[model samples]
Target: MVILFNKPFGVLSQFTPEAGHKALDEFGFPAGVYAAGRLDHDSEGALLLTDNGPLIKKLLDPKFGHPRTYLAQVEGQITEEAIKKLSSGVEIKGYRTKPCIAEMATEPENLWPRTPPVRFRANIPTSWVRLTLTEGKNRQVRHMTAAVGFPTLRLIRTKIGNIPLEGLQPGQWRFVQEKVI
Candidate 1:
C-alpha cells in the first residue's frame, strides 16, 4: 500500500521516537511501512509512506527524479532577480543545486492557519515562492531560500511527483495508487 500523509509541522518524518515531539504513530499507520521520502521536523507537507517493495524501491531510487513541489513563505520582498537566481540554482552548504523552477506564488487562499504561527515583523514583509525540485536534500528548500537572501519563514510541500496535498489536513493520511505518485 502507498500512503500519502500530510505531515504536520514539528512532526518527525520517521515513525520513531524522539524527545519532546510526536512521531507518526500519533497519526497512525500500519506497522512496517516506511516513508519513501523524509520531510524535516520543521517542514510540513506531503510525505509518502509505503509497504510495497516495488513502490519503495522506485521512490528511493535517485534515477527517477520525482518532483517535489513546495510553497515557501519567505522573509523580505523577493525580487525578480532572486527568483531568477533560484531558478538557476544556488549553492547551499557547499553543494550547488541543479537548475529548477522557481516562481512567485500568491499566498494560498485555502491554507490553514498554522499554530504558533510564524513570527511577524512589523517592518519586514514575506512573499510566497513556488519551488519545484527533483532532488531531495537536507533542509534544501530552507537553505536555498536563505542562500538567495530571503530566509524562509514557512515551507509547505504541496506535491510529490503528480500527487498533491489535495486538501488533506495536518496529520491526516490516505492510501494512494502507485501511479498517482
Candidate 2:
C-alpha cells in the first residue's frame, strides 16, 4: 500500500531512531512501510511512503523527471528579474538546475502553519513563492534561493507528481492506493 503524509517540522523521515529524538513509530505506522524520499528535518510538507520498492524507485529517481512543487517563503523583496532568473535556471553550487517553474503566490491557500515558526525580521519582508522542480537535490530549493540573493526562510513541499498533500494536516497520514493497470 502507498501512503501520502504531511510531515511536520522536526520529524525524521525514517522509522529509525537517532539520539534523543522521536521516530515514525510515534506517528503510528505499521511495520514494513518506508518513506520513498526524505524531507529535511526542518522542512514540513508532503511525504510519500510505501512498501513497494519499484514504485518507490520510480518516484525518487531523477531519471523519471517527476515534478515536485514547493511553497517557499523567502527573505527580502523579490524582483521580476530574480523570478526570471529562477525560471531560466540558477547555477547552484557547481551544477545548473534544469528550467523550473517559479512564480509568486497569488493567494495563500493549502499551506500549513509551521511549528515553532520562522524567524522574522522587522525591516525585511518575506514573499511566498511556488516552485516546481523535476529534480530533487540535497537542499536544492534553499540553495537556489540563496544563490540568487534571496534566502529561503521556510520551505514546504506541496505536491509530488499528480498526488498532493490535500486534506492532510501536520503529522497526519493516510493510505493511498495506486492503480496497477
Candidate 3:
C-alpha cells in the first residue's frame, strides 16, 4: 500500500518521537508502512509512505531524477536574477546542486495557516518561489535560497513526482494508488 501524508510543522519524519518533537506515530499510520523519504522537522508538506521496499528505493534513488517541488517563503523581494540563479543551480555545502526549475509564485490559494506562524518583519518584505528539484540534498532548498541572498522563512513540499498534495491538510494521510508513484 502507498500513503500520502501532509506532514505538519514540528513533526519528525520518523515513527519515533525524539527530543520532544512529534513523529509520524502520532498520526496513526498503519503498520508495515514506512516513509519513502524524509521531510525535515521544521518543513511541512507531502510525504510519501509505502510498504513496498522496491518502490521506496525507486522513489528515493537520485538516479531516477524524480522531481520534488517546494514552495518557499523567503526574505526580501526575490529578484529575477536570483530566480535565474536558482534555476541554474548553486553550490551548497560544497556540492553544486543539479539544475532545476525556480520561479516566482504567488501564495497557494488553498494554503492553510501555519501553527505559531512565520515571523513577520515590518520593514523587510518576503516573496514566494516555486522550486522543483530532481535531487534531494540535506536542507537543499533552504541552503539554495540562502546562497542566493534570500533566506527561506518557510518551506513546504507541494509535490513529489506527478503526485500533488491535492488539498491534504496538515497531519492528514490517505492511501494513494501505487500507480501514482
Candidate 4:
C-alpha cells in the first residue's frame, strides 16, 4: 500500500513507542508499512509510507533524486541575498548541498494551527520561503536557513514528487495508487 500521511508536529515518523511523542502506529496504518522518508518530530508535512520494499527503495535512492518541497517560516525578513545563498546551496554537517530552488513566499493560506505554536517574538518579524531539494538530510532545511541568516521558526512539507499534502489534515492518511505516482 502507498499512503500519503500529513504528519503533525511532535510526532515521530516511525511506529516505535516513544515517551511524550506520538508515533505512526497510533494512526493504525497497515502492519509492515514503513516510512519511505522521515520528517523529524519537530517538523510537520507530507510523509510517505508503504509496505512495498521495492517501492520504498525506488523513492529513497539518491540517484532518483525525488524532489521534496517545504514551506519554511524563518526569523526576520528574508532578503534577496539570503534567497540567492539558499539557491546556490549551503554546507551542513560539513557537506555542501546540491543547488536547488528557493524563493520568498507568502504564508500558506490553509495552514493548520500548530499545537503549542511556534515561538513568537513581537520585535522579530518572520517571512516565508519555498525550498525544494532532492536530497534528504538530517534537519537540512533548518540547517540551511540558519546558515543563510534566517533561522527557521516553523517548517512544513507541502509536496513530495507528484503527491502533495492535499485534502489531509494533521494526522490523517489516505491510500494511493503506487503505479500512478
Query: Of the candidates shown, which would achieve the greatest TM-score relative to the real structure?
Result: 3
Arrange candidates, best lDDT first. Answer: 3, 4, 1, 2
Task: Give Cα-based local distance difference scores for all models.
Answer: 0.89, 0.84, 0.93, 0.91
Clashing pairs in 1: none
> For model 3, which pairs clash?
none
| Per-residue lDDT over 1-181 for candidate 1, one digit per residue giving the tens place of the 0 to 100 score | 7889999998988877698767887877988788887888888989998887887788778788789999999999899999999999999988999888999999998897787699999999999999999888889999999999999999999999889998799988899865844
Score residue 45 of candidate 4 by CA lDDT.
Answer: 91
**lDDT (Cα, tens digit) per residue for candidate 2, span 1-181:** 8888888888888887677655676788767898999898788888888899998888877888888899888998777878888898999989999999998874257566777889988998988778999999999999988988889888889888878777889889988764421
RMSD of 1: 1.2
When summed lDDT is taken over every stretch of 10 residues in candidate 4, the lowest stretch is 172-181
Q: Which stretches of candidate 2 lie over 4 Å from their true place?
A: 106-110, 178-181
For model 3, residues 73-104, the per-residue Cα lDDT tens digits are: 99999999999999999999999999999999
